[model samples]
Target chain A: MNIPLLSLKSILSRPLSTLLSWLLMSFGVTIVVLILLVSAQLKNEISKNAQGIDLVVGAKGSPLQLILCNIFHVDFPTGNISLKEANNLSRNRYIESAIPMSLGDSYRGYRIVGTTKAYGDLYGAEIQSGQWFEEDMKAVVGANVANLLGLNLGSQFQSQHGMSEEGEEHEEQSIIVAGILAPSSTILDDLILVSIPSIWNVHEHEEEPGEHEGEIIDLPKLGIAVSQEQLEEEEITSILIKYRSPMAAVMLPRMVNEVGNFQAASPAYETARLFNIIGVGVDVVNIIGILIVVISAISVFIALLHSLKDRKYDIAIMRSMGATRRQIFVHVLMEGLLIAILGCISGLVLAHAAIGILAFYLEKLNLSWSFFVNDEVWVLTGGLIIGMLAAIIPAGLAYKTDISKTLSKA
Target chain B: MIQIAGLSHCFSDNVVISYPDWQVADGEHSLILGASGSGKTTLLHLMSGLLKPTNGSVIFDTQEINQLSPSRMDKFRGAHVGLIFQKPHLIAALTVKENIKLSTFLGKKPEHNRHIEEMLDSLGLIELAHRKVHQLSQGQAQRVAIARALINHPKFVFGDEPTASLDDESCMKVVELLKRQSDQHGATLVIATHDQRVKNHFSNKLEL
Candidate 1:
């Protein structure tokens, strides 16, 4: 009872140690929190986009990568699956909707995705300016790209042929910015979208006035438009398939692998894989947290134990005044608990600050995911428990103190 | 009222004390007199229930104070006993008034009720009551300690070498203050000290 106030004052008295303990504890918790926050947000974004659309049918590489590159503008595609094959598959009774993508180009480091208008409405994207491209050479840019590049409707921009901004051009095909999308808190935030034929037209144009003139250049084929008559005429990278029922989930990956060059990956499986990848980082942080808690406990124990020596006269005075050993024990234990509680609160505040910084960076880089997820309470509770554990060993020492030996020495 | 029977103690192999018995009636003023290492502090520790006697019982009222659980003894001590140290040992973080208030708070006693100023007025500490413990001088800190002890109006008062560091004048003032306050409340007063200067003041004494 009396321990609460006394412990609070004692902790306040040693501001430096309390602050250090708080930082150390929060640092560990922050990493764990960041991992949890980002992963959950990523999962939410995936699941949200994946809703209604049941399965992904793609060229047989990494299904997760295909999803990331196609559905989400976060990575480069392995390649594209045939459009004719995709169209044929769309006619299946189980297939509800189908959209195709032609990739490989960037406008100022933002991906130039050559896809349909369904890409926008599927992810619930809104065009703030102009309209979705219906013509071959028109483009629709994400809100972040529009703002960052200061581009507006009808502005003509050229796309580079690779991931980098400085990637070489295959031809000077000017694209009109037909639309700009609103922020959808998804992969749609960092893209320069255009009609799929725009990608085909850009690559199909004759090479410009270069020294290698009159050379008939071949297009570095990424994916083919699948035609039943000439199925082997072109190469294709990957495809995204949507199924009507759980039957596709069970049978599609098996069938797609048996048939296509690309791999069929479920985002769910890949997300779990991502979790396993990050779980090691969490484990390291947890070990550091446990160590800091133990060290903090030791710090408290040593501080109290050393104080007990200097406080002999003080203890003698209290004892003389009629404080029992139990009272003194409670007094000391309260001090430790108070310090732990203070450290925990400070750590939680610190973790949130770190989260803010991380969120800002993610936004700046136009990263599709966020580190501020919904499960904040878990991190806060975890920090408090660690702080409480740190106080236990020191408080226990106070309980075993022998008053007679202590006072006699004085 | 207080009573002790066949109390004995040792420190890891060294026999520090082996007293037969001791008794103090209500309202008695006694000095536990002894040389250095003669177990005067040990005797005070037993009386306060800070240490249990290896053998013997210390009875205060109808209960064996020595037999009480540690927490129970603490509650009893916080509520009914007042202690004064030679060094004053006030918590350095608190102001003089706050230090006294702390004791009352711990004891669960009624608020000192702005009578903290009145108490400080008696001890000539009113002007300095708002100052922190570390800000006070030797004599001022000792006066603050006295105000703190008396704030709870405890039934028994114990002084462990209360005036050991004070000059003749400050010591006399402190002793007179202690006797006046103890007599005013009809409380039992126990002083454990090697200082002989306090001998002429009390009517009753316990020499070890």
Candidate 2:
């Protein structure tokens, strides 16, 4: 109590220096913590959405784009590959399972994905209402999609021509909501799922007698349906593959890419590459945070050193009153400790404040934020240690003050 | 009783200062009279154990202060001696009352709040006790410094030109206050000063 009161008075007596030191320290800590939180959140979101899909096969294009389109469901696929060729890879001895996905439509702004019950099985999806789609034009909605679009069991909505809001609407065709999937908390939660026949039927009706007027229409033939004009060759946007063995990871992507007409991408490799690109930006932010923290520590050291020099006479007086060198040393160190603790606490609040803003924005997009990670605790401890280290030199100088010489000079 | 024998000091340049042997009886107030280069402050510091002498010892009764370890020397000084410096230095951050409290804490005594309050009341500083040191006038600050030095009521009180900068009237007042406080507490008092106004305040004079 005695030491604390003395240190508090000393700090209060020099208000401007104390405040300047604290603000700098807190700002530096906040930035460091901000970057860590963002980096952690970004890595978690990417990996969570990717799940365990081992490989993606798409029309020849950027592998990154293939993973983004097929696995993460964030970008448009590079046109489409033949369903026959995609199925051929499904039969590969090293492949455990393959799920094909066809996408070119949206209800509202969320994509309508044409997939099989296997895709739902791959994600461990459970039905919240009704049952899975059994026939053409029957759709199963994901939890978030159902909530955001207000399409419950038995609701119906028409599909748009492409996966964008401005796509031409397929007004003549509407899909019935056969079921709603429970919350998977993955990319699937944002999608409206239907079977493959629905995609073909919707597009098949798109260019019929209304536009043909008995004119010869050049339609790529699908083997299943030549009763009407043959549509374009049957295609799907991509295939998601699960490898049967750990060794398949070495050969699968290479084998699929060797097929020439199509290319293969690994979710891990593509996501790593994407993060490497983003890591450059995160690295810059990290460097800036480190510089700010270092400068804050230096400023604290300077503030303490300058005050120690100024208080020589006061130190001499304390000595005359019989203060031990150790007492004086601890007295000055207390100043540093008080400043550091206050700054650390303020920085934590600032870090949480920034996270609050980020979490709010993520929630609006139907995404959840993860907090309470181990790195945050480390930051708090490291910040306080730096504060104490900054004071060490100044405290030693106070302990070595020559009392009699200082008093005689005074 | 304070005893000194063959005490001396030297600068790195080999300029040596030698002191004549002297004894100050308990409760006796003495003044060391000297000019600017007379080493009066040096003598005061050496005898008070602020600086170890080059040759010889200062013994308060039978205990040789210079022979104590650094920490033990500080403990000894706190319990047995008090000092008033020329400039009336106090911690600028603390109130007058807190400065006295700090002194008592550093004195190595079991907590002595009652003694600090009595010192403040005796020094007429009870009203200004809560005011910060910077807010006090020079004279009030000097009184607070005195109260701090004497709060422990040591066996000896030493002043290093405590009244050199004050006007004659205030100087006399300060010297008289130092003497009266030391007498009431039964501690020996020694003032190192060239100021002529302090000459009449003490009977035993040591001319350096």
Candidate 3:
């Protein structure tokens, strides 16, 4: 009938080759799209969670580990730093604000971070229900922590000693969920927030059983105003610092590393370094995906050229039936274009479905990716260009078919 | 009516075939008789505007087709002429009815499913309308080709050895169908074949 319908029938006439070209194209597109989604989301997650914090000053260890532990919460803490030394560094004029976090305990694999109200402010966190923790043992749960662990207001759970579920539970120090934070699309959504004293009290009960029995020392809330004696004896994990001025960016990290027993790491510098280290593997895989797409284009070219040999007489017959050279040319080109359009659309669908499944399994990372992106339009356009390139020569050959000679051969 | 004057085609420097002047009135059935290598197919191709002659003009009702551009010639031939070859060159991917429908599609004629069905009915192919072309016998495929050629109701029907490979009974049957279909559609029938079995059917002849 019409050229498009005729082109479709011609493509269907040879099933195996068409399938091969289609599968290769879709496979290549899937790989390319998946990589784009993951890398973009990874960069977004890293930067968003690390916003506002100028430096992470923790125990003497790998600066990257210090950042990973205190900022991103994906790695183990280097060790603990004395509260006296950390408080002294917080008093430095270059530091605008400092939030002290004491991390070591968990409840059902979600880390229970102990800090003041400023930690919630750092991420623009808002309470979704109930209220913020007001007492030492009262806890505020992140949106993800609340949903995943089914924690609601007044839900009581004891702290575990370590970050994993197998850690020893401190039954005597039960923590009650005081409130739940709204989803902020940051690392805050994956944590449980408690006061610093809650973590210290849980450990102090085990370390010195009856010595600090009824002496519930409520330290001042705003500036971490512990007595000199208490500050000397207590230890905390890390302090997240914001710079007072741009000059602090150059002068502060050096001051902490040289003057105090601490390692200060810049979140911006470390994440870029991390991406550079991961980029080599990403580039290699991206190259392979592009190579597969190019090969599929070649496969399409060869298939069309090969089929043209058998269909020469058929094309001649169409010409005899009054098909113009241009019509014949467009008919052949439409086949290739059809294959590309089909392959690109299916590839995008396959890629999105795969990412959805991956995001489901890796939900603990709190990663979110979109189903459609602007870069995929380029992928579609590239596919169509390749399709046209592959079909042009074959279509031109069909256009030049000598009708009288071909029909006379019979 | 069709008119041809000073028709000759050149294949190469040393090979040229010239055709004598001829004219056929409207709705007349004529045969071009010749042996192998006698330019019968070439003359048929020129008359149908499939090929442009080196020195000739084919006039159909005062329209000089050879003077038309390639694109216009193709549209002209599609609108006014239908062709059949020695082998039924049906596109294998399409069914029997689809093959007939292709004529109306390419000829830029308005599609009429009823006309296609009637054509197939008269050809005794109504039952096999949905079957793929490869499944049909030689005679059956040729009949499908005839149905395709007549689908657009073209002014001229050209057959180049339409029944060359069939037995005597099938050959005569095909010739009868061609004449009958052309007559029904008010088309002039022009067939080029060396088969002696075809001579008894057509009274007008051009021999080379």
Candidate 4:
């Protein structure tokens, strides 16, 4: 008891050494904390955005890319599926909801996703003010779109050809901001949402009206519209199905994927695959963490061995006062353990502060990452283990030191 | 009370000292006299239970310390053996009083503030009680170690070349101080030294 207390005081006296070990240990721990924060946030964002939708049926290109573009709001869709195929899928009894999405327009690099009221309802997204789009070329802005573009409920803007920085398009069709959505803390907060008919009408006027031959004749019947008189089917980009029974879970998706031109994807499967992909990187982080801990242990061992020369007389005196070799051993090891604890605490605090600073950027990317996530308890636990593990080598050295030889050398 | 029989020690397989028998009675003031390699320090280390004898036994009262496990011996030593080293081994990070309090904490005893204050008062160290050990002069730090050694009220006290680093005048004063305190506490006192300045102070002498 006296020896451990004495050893603690000795460490506190040597401020520079204590601080050096603390900083070194913190360096390794901070990286581990940062990786967990970023990965978990990205995973959470993808899963949250994938909610409510059961299937994403797109053109026979990259199903992952189409899902990314339409649902997760990243990259370009591989291609579009036919309207007839979309309509036939909606006719299935297992399909509870269908939301058509048309892309290929932007307002100042922010995407303009031409969708319907059903799109908002699928996710239970609400309008902050005004109403959903009831007219063609009308739009409802996301929270970020409203904030970044400074668009009010009645404000009007023009659409661009793509989300590129080239500034190539001059042709503009006026788009009125009919409604704005409350922030969902998801991908919904960043897009310019509008009715699907608005996108169809934009291509209708792509040419100079007088120079185009019979443009008027093709225009009226050009786009597919849902008829008021009930039809057995209708065309759309994708149909998100919610099964009334688990039988549909087994039967309907297989039926949709195999029997039709459209391909069905479960958001659940895609999310699982996304996690598996990210897990490879996490495995690398764990390896690096283990390596850092090993290095930290070696550092502690060397530093302690280095300090033992100066501590010889001190150990001898304690020995003379009836402290056993084992007591001296515990005393030295305790000093190392103290250094580890200091490092672990500092590392955890550093990690929390780093996440707090990056929160804004994370939000901008529509990825919600909290510094104090559920797994942080494990991170702290792991960091402490690393710190203690690092101390063991030093402790072992201290244990093996020959007290008589050491005192004689002095 | 203490007893040593056929105690011997070696460093790097080289014999440093071998003694056939030695003993000090309770409340005796004994001085061990020797040249550089005479094993006076080795005798003190064995007597205080800091070093295990390569041969024979060191009995403090009835306990043969060579047989006690290192950790158990540390507890026994902390509780009953008070040691003052040649150079003060006071922890540099702690204030004077905190260093003294560490003994109590390690010994698992409630703080005896009255005894500490009395020790400090007798040694004229009360005013320096809050100063860091690093801030103390050699003489002042030596006096602090003396105070720390006596604070535990041990039955025996060991001083290893305690005055070797001090000036003549300070060395004489330190010896007088240690002798008077040992007498006041009725504790056996052993001084292992070649200083010769403390020769006349101890009534009982062991020549090596």
Interface RMSD of 4: 2.9
CA shift of B185, model 1, Å: 3.7
C-alpha TM-score for every candidate: 0.82, 0.88, 0.95, 0.83
Total backbone collisions, model 1: 22
Per residue, candidate 2 scores C-alpha lDDT tens digits across A1-410 of 27878988998899998998788778888888888877776677778767768888888989898888887677888888876666566778888777778888888888899888878887889999999988778999989889878998889889998777888998888899999999987777888899876887788764542232234332122112222222335688887787899999988878888875889888898889998999898889878876776777788789888987779888877877778899888888888888878887898788878788776776423323336568878877877788788888998999999877887777
Taken over the whole model, the C-alpha lDDT of each candidate is 0.70, 0.82, 0.88, 0.73
Candidate 1 achieves a global lDDT of: 0.70
Query: Tens-digit lDDT track for model 1 on B80-150?
Result: 88877767888764678877777777676766557777888988998997786788989889888988888
DockQ each: 0.45, 0.64, 0.80, 0.46
Clashing residue pairs in candidate 4 (N, C-alpha, C atoms within 3 angstroms): A87-A234, A87-A235, A297-A390, A322-B74, A324-B70
In order of DockQ, best first, we have 3, 2, 4, 1
**For each candidate, how many residue pairs have backbone atoms clashing (under 3 Å)?**
22, 2, 0, 5
Residue-level lDDT tens digits of model 4 in A28-89: 77777777777777777777777777777665556676677778777776566665556666
**Best candidate (score: TM-score):** 3
Which ranking of candidates, highest TM-score first?
3, 2, 4, 1
Least accurate 10 contiguous residues by lDDT in model 4 chain A: A214-223
Candidate number with greatest lDDT: 3
- State the number of backbone clashes in model 2: 2
For candidate 1, the TM-score is 0.82
